[model samples]
Target: MTAMASVISKITAKNQVTVPKQVRQALGLKEHDQLRWIAKDDGSIEVKKANNNDFWGVVMEQQRRYGSINTPEPAWGPDVGGEVID
Candidate 1:
């Protein structure tokens, strides 16, 4: 279920606007927070709270730069060894 919050704000000249209180609280946003936006083919817009410090985007970039780490399992050291035969 989704909780509906009512917020009212106006768009500035450069399409910049402040997020209202109820909306911000609902989204758990704070000052100097970051938001990710994607414009869909349709006029309708879908928005969701982005991960902390843009982790998703950074992970993708890291993968592209430093390939994937899918190496085979490494051998364990002296498994099933008898109690130190000192």
Candidate 2:
């Protein structure tokens, strides 16, 4: 019989997330299965399926945003609040 299922995972108070049982079985994933998170152009996070040994196997490209940010930049230069040492 074929095995496959769809489910949603929730993050815990400790910033930990658990994969549903059905999904784990379908993806052949067990505890400690390595996964990677990516930020899209809209700043939305996407979770992609990956192999444990392939954590750094794939290189992610930079996303470009179409609009300008309305936030102001911090004025923390090289001399913020520390002493200067030449």
Query: Which one is best on TM-score?
Result: 1
The per-model lDDT (C-alpha) reads: 0.75, 0.63
- Alpha-carbon shift of residue 43 in model 2 (angstroms): 4.5
lDDT of 1 at 57: 82
- Model 1 C-alpha lDDT per residue in residues 4-81, reported as the tens digit of each score: 755578999999988777777777888877666767998766656767677878788688999876788898867786
Residue ranges of candidate 1 with Cα displaced over 4 Å: 54-56, 59-86
Report the C-alpha lDDT of model 2 over 1-86, residue by residue, as the tens digit. Answer: 26445467889999998877675666677666666688899989866566545433432211133343457989876765877799
Q: What's the TM-score of every candidate structure?
A: 0.51, 0.41
Candidate 2: worst-modelled 10 consecutive residues by lDDT: 58-67
- Among the numbered candidates, top lDDT falls to 1
- Model 2 regions more than 4 Å off: 1-6, 54-86
